[model samples]
Target chain A: MLRIGLFVVTVIGALVAAAPLIAIAGSNPLSAYRALLQGSLGSRRGLAETLIAATPLLTCGLAVAVSFQGGLFNIGVEGQLVIGGLIAGAIGAEVSLPAGIHVVVAILGAALGGALWALVPALLKAFRGVHEVITTIMLNYVAFSVSTYLVSPGGPLVSKTQPSATEKVKATAHLARIWQPTRLHLGVVVAIGLCAACWFFLYRTTAGYRLRMVGANPTAAQFNGINVRGVVVRTMCLSGALAGCAGAIEVLGLHGRYFDSFSPGYGFDSIAVALLGMMNPLGVAAAAAFFGMLRAGSVLLQAKAKVSKDMVTVISGLVVAFVAARVVLERRLESSASRRDRRRRDG
Target chain B: MADVFSINLVVSGIYLSMPLILAAFGGLLSERSGVINMALEGEMLFGAFSAVAFTWWLGSPWLGLLAALMTGALIGAIHAWLSVTLRANQIVAATAINLIASGLTAALIETVWGKPGVSPSVRKFGIVHIPLAGHLPFLGRIVERLTVLDWAGLLLAPIVWIVLFRTSFGLRLRSCGEGPEAAASVGVAVISVRYRAVILSGMLAAAGGAYLSLAQVGVFQRNITGGRGYLALAAMIFGKWRPVPVLGACLLFGLADAFQFRAQVAGVNLPHDLLLALPYLVALVALATFVGRASAPAAIGKHFIKD
Candidate 1:
């Protein structure tokens, strides 16, 4: 019941956040809501598309959430994801195997790629005391370049002259849609399973407890002999792995090739999603889906409502701005509550 | 050939070094005075965009520079008001400023120019010939053919060094950054000192942004800073919070950038990403091998309030 109440509040918040999009769409606010609901969840096709869109975001949000839970901001998830995609794409270009084994390699390679990208920043933070936020941001740019170099036209972007992607990752490597003509594929299952796994790890495991304790207070954790530095490194690596998986899924299941600059700032978006979801794996999952719907329906909204496609960014930016401006939010809520209290007292 | 290249490399180093110097110097001032300013990049972006727009409009690069400086100062004052005065979390405030700047700037570009990427190239401030040095030897060869701003930056090095170390006012400012409580106890108005430091940082970062637009690239692009602000932050760290090392770190980054630029020009089929990633990789290497046990100011980021 508590979860349901929180979910409803967040949903309303999302709608309120998307108000600017409504104005841009030139449709009445209520009509925009109806269109969004009908377009994303009202039909089986819409639901599947939303699920597909949610897959990478869900995993990426969890990746960010897990790291933030450990008090380490992981902004390199985009970079990690890109590296993972490159590895997956490279593997995809090589051998032929049973689809299952091929998928396993793709996922594994991606996880490793993300983890490796994160390792540098993790080491610097642990050993040299450099801020991960700064390091991770710089790494993101490097990741962008690395992926572009790997997948450019002369490289993996063009194997032959058809202007198609790196020769279709052996037929076995493809993550075919589970539902025909829908974007839904094997990755959605993985995303949900991983979310469950994260919830259990954070709430039920001893290792997770140590991480939480360390995240809350490193000095106290150190006094208690908990290896704070070790936890920081491990959590960051784990976080990067999940983020890398997001990239891998996008490549293996959706696009089937490593594309240069594929992400539209997923790493930064995940920051807002993780925070809005209160850093709960379940909440992050829900938030990711909510974002997924917005993204999936945005194309339709733009076409039918005559809105510039960029309205979605404005809406997302507003949501992040509102959430981050917690001081302003708290003050508004406080003043409103006090006014009500004054009325009650006088009455 | 490599020597000429190396000389050109060092010249590019000096060129790239100036902006980082400006941004890092700004960051140091804000950080030293107890504010963790992550909005340095945003301040630069604000400067970069304004500089381009002003240059396009007025055709005087100096006017563009002035616009950038003001934009940077405005952002700094906004940050100081929210974080320093209102006691908001400095990181959160800075992040908000960054986001707002990004979205608003892009939106402004779309509305104004109908494009989301780089602005039109303008004739900007660039290499200037020093009157007598061009006629002289090795030192003259290096120093004579430099940008007006390049000379200003080298000029600023000792000026800032003296202001920070030699003067009583500099002592009071450092006191505000190092230990506000100590400074406050001694009757220094810690808040005002910090406010001034941050404002100065914003102004310098803004000027650096203008340098990027009006001098470096001569055009504005979304995210044109491309992690330079963080690079500046890294330099600030590697410099151990001092002016000389700050300049050195910037020069190192500039050298890396110059090499990458030359390598790309040579078209050696070296992955562009490797070149793009060079500065960050060098930063990590520099921090790991070079900087040893650098300690930040004691009261950095802790807001001091007299109860």
Candidate 2:
């Protein structure tokens, strides 16, 4: 019952956080929400756009969620996405193969690229005890710089002299769309499937159980004979792999080619979505869809209202803070309960 | 021409290092207190934007710098509320600050200037060549070229060192950071001390941002600090949360940045892309070495709730 109360407050916080955006829009905040719901669900086109926007977010949110489950904050998803896309684009433009093979190569290449991006931090955290949060962030800047160079004129990675882009992927390599008009594609389905897979991996399997135990209490897990060190490295690796695949999926299923500086921090934004979702894979999917709707609606909101599109971001931030506050409060309540139990037993 | 290039590189290195050192020191305070203080970048943005906006109005960069400091303090207060008093997840609060700061600054710039970005021309923070320092050779030249902000920022290290290790307030701050329970037992007001430390840290970081806008650039860009806050935080971490070491880390990163720009200008055939990756690479390498087993204050990143 208390848990339910916590959940209600979480939603209320989200609503309150979203209030400023509506006020800025000069519409009834309820109407603004109605428009958002109507805009996204009013027609098939709206739904498609919501789903389209959610596609990358769902993948990225899961990527973030996986890391949180492993006691690591993999905030470098933005960097990994770019790295994966760069590799895929580098390969996608050059490789000549059957459409299936070409697509597979790009996807696999992107995943590898993302994993490689994660490797440095994983190694650093595992051996050097560097905090993943700090290194991954620094790595993000490096990733951006490298990606910028790759896409810039006279860059070794891409012909920088050209407009900031790489060669488009082959037509055959394009993702099959669920809707012809909107951006909805195979990646959405793939994202959901991956979420299910992650759900299974974290909940159903012994390895998953050990990973959760480690996340919840590393010492306790160690006492229970769990290979804590091994879990840290492998779980981080797994998290990175998921993050890499998110990047790969975005590039292949949507953008159709890798390019430097494509995502406007989808990786980072997913962190918010993951938190909102309570770090559960299924919850991530739901939160991603909601966030994606707001994202897709931002342009529309701007076009209709004079409010700067950036206000949407402010709302997102407030929501994240509120969610975090809730998490902290919940933990405190749980610990207090346990302490009470301890006192009762002692008495 | 070669000498000119080297001189310019040295100038640029210190120029870049100024704000970073200040912000990292600011981070050092909070990190020592156990808060991650990710909002440093946003606070810097607040400083940069407010400084540029007000300086343009008041016609004095000094006033602009003060405004930036106040803004940073306010931001620091907000962070303190969320992360310290409210006991929220530090990263969530920090990252939220980053996004909100970026978005708010962009939006505010639009509202204030009636332009999307790069605010209207303001009084540029001028170059201050110290008369005495101007006499020396290459080394003297670098010192002479330092701006007013540069001098103030350079002095921050020793001041922070004293405050963090020598002063009573500093001791209390560390007590809260290293172990809040012990700190509370010792009669230190753990939450209040942390609030002071983190807010002061924000004010300092804002000064860094002010250096960027009021002095470094005449205008503001949406992503102006461009992950420098994170870099500074890394420097703090690499410095292992120590004042002098944090300064060292900032200089190291500043050097990487300075060299990268020089290398780019020298126009070598080697991939400039690689140069771009060097700071991050250096960070990874540094973390692998010094970051290993680096002990943090026990209560760092964990909020102390009174039992």
Candidate 3:
């Protein structure tokens, strides 16, 4: 109940903060918000669009959450996703196979690409004692640069005819559409399935238990004979694979091609989503959907309300800040309460 | 002509190094005080935006620099409050600040200036010439062309080294980073010291951002800092949290940036993106190869608990 209350408060606080900005932009906050709702949920098409946007975010959220569970901060999700998507795109355009096989191959390619991208940071953290945060962040720029080069005019992945993007993926590689009016595809179902799979992997499996044990206390885990180093590297690889799938899904489901700078910070946004959802799969799904709605609605907010799409970024940032602040506040309260209880007993 | 070109390259490199040294110095102050300031990027961005915005409003680059410092310090206080007082995850708190700054600055730019892409150009600091020395042969050419801001920024390294190593306040700050419990036992207030250090750090970083906007670009773009804050953090690590070494690292990065720009001007056939990626790639390589085993403050990311 407290969690629900906090969530409501955060949402309200973010909206309130955004209200003035909307007003400054010469739009009525209430009407603009109403338009946002209408844009994201008023029609079946709008709902489908929301689902489409949420799909990759859910996968990326899972990626970050899984790594967080392993006590590793994976800031390379953006790079991993980009590399994975590029591999998927290349495979989709070049390979010829049956629909099922083609899709599987492309997805696998994406997973491989992401894993390769994540390998450097994982090794550095596990063996070399390097911090994952900075390395991962650095890799993000490297991935961006490499991907851009590959898709640019002289790059190998660039289409002969279209200079800015890779060639179209084969029809067989495309995720089949579930909703006719919208871009909703099998990617959503796959994303959900992956979320369920992640939940199972984290909760039910012995390896998962070991990974969590390491995260909880690395020294204790080591004393218990757990191979802490192996777990760290493996956990990163698994997380990277999930992020890779997010990239592949985007290419296979919606764009059907890979272009430079396709994502507008979806990978980074997933970190907040994971935190907001308390690192739970179901919670991540809900959080991703909420953000997805805001993103989907931002277009309408821009079009009808004359508000800039950047306003959504401000709102999301506010929500993230508020959520983090609440967690910190709650912890302080708990500590203080315990302290008070001890004092009373001692007295 | 090549001599002039070389001089231009060196001067531009120094110009690029100015913001980095300031921001990295800020990182150093916070880290030395046991607070991991991952929000340097956000602080710099806010500083960059505020510097240009204030400069436009006040029509004075000096006042704009002051505004940037205050804004940076204010954001730093928020970060210190979240990380130190609330014991929030420092990384998460910093990330929040980055997002908030990115969004809020962009929104403000759009709402106030009516343009989402870039802000209006503002008055900027002028170039300086070391009067007598500027007339000398080799050094004169480069020294005469350096901006006033660049000279001050370069001088900051030695100043920070002195403050961090020579002062009693610096001792307390270092003690907090090394062992807060020990610091607290010795009649030192760990929390307040950290707060002050972080806020001061933010102000210094804002000076870096102001240099970017008012001294370098003369206008604020959405991401004017452009990961230079992170580069500064990398430099901090590369310097092993010391002022002098960090200055050298910043200079190296600046030189890479200067080379990229010069190459672009020379119409080099390399992909533009590749050229842009050079500095980041160099930092990554440096981090992995040379700085992998670098030592950090003992209690850097640890939350202090009053037991």
Candidate 4:
């Protein structure tokens, strides 16, 4: 019940915060919101696009949620995702295998690539006690540099026809489309399945309990015979694998290859999505869906309402800010309720 | 290869280090006051945007600098209100600030300039030759063509050091960071001291941003701070949060950047991308090997509640 209240307050707060930005763009907030809704949910094509956009966000949001559950902030999801996409694209282009097997190998390669990218920070955080935030952020730049170098002109993995991308992924490796007259693919189903698996793993397993204990109180968990360091490493790798799958699905389903900059900060946005979802798998799906609507509808929002697509960014920012300050709101409500109770008792 | 160590390289290195130095000091002040300020990047970016936008509108570089400082203060106050007064999670609040800065700046560029990504060139600060420094030895060559902002960046280290170490206000601020509960018990206004530290930190960081748009580039570009704010954070950690050492760390990074630029021009047998990644690689290695949380302020990242 409290969660629902928080969600409602957050949405209202975000809209209130974004009203001024909409005004700055010379558009009425009401009409702009109407256009946004119309563009995202008013038609079949819009709904399909929203689902398509949500696929990676759902996967990436799970990745961030998993890390948060384990008391780690895996900000390197962006880097890991890029590495995963690059590996998946390369495998899809270079490997020769049967249809079903090719896709499996490519995705596994992507997962391994992402896990390896995260391994350094995981080990650093677990063993040396180095902060993952700084290491992960630093590695993000390294990942960008490495990815750019590989696809640069005359560099290996550069497509013959396109200087800034890898060769197209083989048709055998493509994530088959599931819907007609829409770009929806098998990846959305996979993302949903992953969400279910994540929910089960985080709630129904002994390992999940250990992970939670470590997060809640490391010293107590340590004294209780939990392998805290190992759990930390494993949690980070699991998070990275999920993040990698996000990238792999984008490559295999949407883009069919790794481009220079395919993601429009989806990994970063997933942080906000995870937080807004209160780190629950189902809640994350809802938040990702909402954000997906914003992204899918942004094109029409810009064209119809004369607002920049960056308006979505502003809204997301406001949502996160409000969510962070929810404690203050909750405290105020509690104080007012308690005052009313005291007054009734006196009467 | 000789050009790698030339007077030109040293001067460029100093010029490049100016922003990092100022921004690292900003991190120093905030962290010393016990508020984790991951919003340095956002504050710096907003400052950069304000510098260019105000300069373009008002037609004066000085006013642009003033505007950047004011906006920095505004951002600082907001951040303090969220993380300090509201007792929100500092990192989450900072992340929000970053996203807002990025989105607001991008949208405003479109609104104000009718274009996206880059803004029009505006009036910029000119070099200020020191009256006597130009006549000195090798140091003179590096300092002679420095801009006024550059000098301010260089001089801010000692000023910050003195303010943080030699003043009663600084002691109170450090005490809040170390033990806010204890400080409050002793009649110190822990909350207000943090607000002041964070606000001052914002102004310094904004000055660093002003240096970028006004002194270095003469224009505002999208994401122009380009993670330099993070680099400053890394530098602060690398310096163990001390002002003078943080200045040294910034210079080291600045020199590395300068070397990378020279190596690219000199046709060094390395990928340009790898060269671009060098400073970050260095920072990562430095953090892994030398730094730990032991040296950090005892009460950093904790929200203090008063009854």
List DockQ, one per candidate, in order: 0.32, 0.60, 0.58, 0.70
Q: For residues A113-177, write the lDDT of model 3, one tens digit per residue.
A: 89888888899889877778788888888888889989887887899988778999999999998
TM-score (chain B) of candidate 1: 0.94
Candidate 4 lDDT, tens digit per residue, B1-307? 7767788778888878888898889989999999988888889998999999999999999999999999999999999999999999898898898888878888888888988889989988998867898889998877788888988888898998899899999899999989999999999998899999899888888888888888998999887887788888888988988888899999988888888888898888888987898888888887788656687888898998878
Question: Which sections of candidate 3 miss by over 4 Å?
Answer: A1-6, A20-28, A332-347, B1-5, B291-294
What is the C-alpha interface RMSD of model 4?
1.6
Q: iRMS of each prediction in angstroms?
A: 3.5, 2.6, 2.0, 1.6
Candidate 4 differs from the real structure by a C-alpha RMSD in angstroms, to one decimal, of 2.1
Identify the CAPRI category of the predicted complex in candidate 1. Answer: acceptable
Listed for each candidate, the true contacts retained, as a fraction, are 0.31, 0.69, 0.55, 0.66
Which candidate's DockQ is highest? 4
Clashing pairs in 1: B32-B177
* Candidate 2 structure lDDT: 0.80
Ten contiguous residues minimizing lDDT sum, candidate 4 chain A: A24-33
Q: Write the residue-wise lDDT of candidate 1 on B203-283 in tens digits.
A: 898888888877877888877787788788888888888888888888888888878887777675676666888988888
TM-scores for every candidate against the unseen true structure? 0.88, 0.93, 0.95, 0.97
> In model 1, where do residues sit more than 4 Å from their true spots?
A1-50, A153-158, A161-165, A297-321, A327-347, B1-4, B126-129, B267-269
| Tens-digit lDDT track of model 1 for A137-220 | 888888887666655566645557434245556667777779987778888988899999999999999998888888889999
Candidate closest to the true structure, highest TM-score: 4
